[model samples]
Target: MGHLSTHVLDTTAGRPAAGVAIELRRLGADGSSEPVASTVTNADGRTDGPLLEGASLQAGTYELLFHVGAYFARTGAGPEQPFLDVVPVRFGVTDPAARYHVPLVVTPWSYSTYRGS
Candidate 1:
């Protein structure tokens, strides 16, 4: 079975980005997106469970939207006029039987993500 999971790291704080809001969405052929799951990061910067697992894993394009603005504000690091607010990560899942660990390394001004182990 395949699985989908994620984690967030706050570059500014140099720690796991706890309490960051994240959303997983499936992209349709007509440029529409459907929300699949939504969750907040834990103390370890990970979701409580795999966002999509077992039979729910599908081969297609997906997007992960991170509420960077809210997260920075909660951490008392938000700027008066934020440069980077919501961060969107879009990628494709080609093999449903594989594990996908999408990780976001972020700060109040910027962010980066990659498919991890």
Candidate 2:
């Protein structure tokens, strides 16, 4: 079945953005968001386990919300007025048998993401 995972890297610090909060959400039929799961990045800037694993995954739209602002502030990498705040990356999952890896590379001012293996 489909699985979801993510990793975070702090481009500004040139390291992992550890202890960052992340939320996984599924889009509801009525066009609203529903929480599927929530997790915080580990010291390696990765989820302790799959965000959504085994039969929990379904083919649909999903969103990963990263709390970059708070992470940067807490880590003393940037001030409250950092360039980037909350960053939301959304993508569609079409294959239930596939593994989906969404990796985020971010700094206080910018970020990037791509479908990873």
Candidate 3:
């Protein structure tokens, strides 16, 4: 069955972005969304388990919210007012049995994401 996972890398520090807050939400067709999961990255910059898996994962649109500002604040990095705060990555799941790994490579000033293994 399909499952979802994520990782965060602190490009500025050249290491995993530990302690970053993350939220997963399933988006509805009516511009509404419901929370699916919430977690913080561990030292390895990954969630302890797949965010969504098996029967719980369906073919649909979803959003992953990364709290970059809070992470920088807690780590004592970045400017007082970070240019990039909460980064929202929205994507669609086309196959129910495929694994989706969305990883974030970020700094206080910028961020990027792509579909990974």
**How many clashing pairs per prediction, in order?**
0, 0, 0
Which candidate gets the maximum lDDT versus the true structure?
3
- Give the distance in Å from residue 48's predicted Cα in candidate 2 to where it truly belongs: 0.4
Model 3 lDDT per residue over 1-117, tens place: 899999999999999999999999999999999999999999999999999999999999999999999999888888998888999999999997999999999999999999999
What lDDT tens digits, residue by residue, belong to model 2 across residues 1-117? 668999999988888889999999999768999999999999999999999977888888999999999999998888768777889999998886799999999988788999999
Which structure among the candidates has the greatest TM-score? Answer: 3
Q: Assess candidate 2 and give its TM-score to the true structure.
A: 0.94
Quote each prediction's TM-score. 0.96, 0.94, 0.98
lDDT of 2 at 94: 88
How many clashes (backbone atoms < 3 Å, residues ≥3 apart in a chain or on different chains) does model 3 have? 0
Model 1 Cα lDDT, one tens digit per residue, 1-117 = 899999999989999989989999999999999999999999999999999998898999999998889888877887977777889999999999999999999988878888999
Q: List the residue pairs that clash in candidate 3.
A: none
Error of 1 at 98 (Å): 0.3
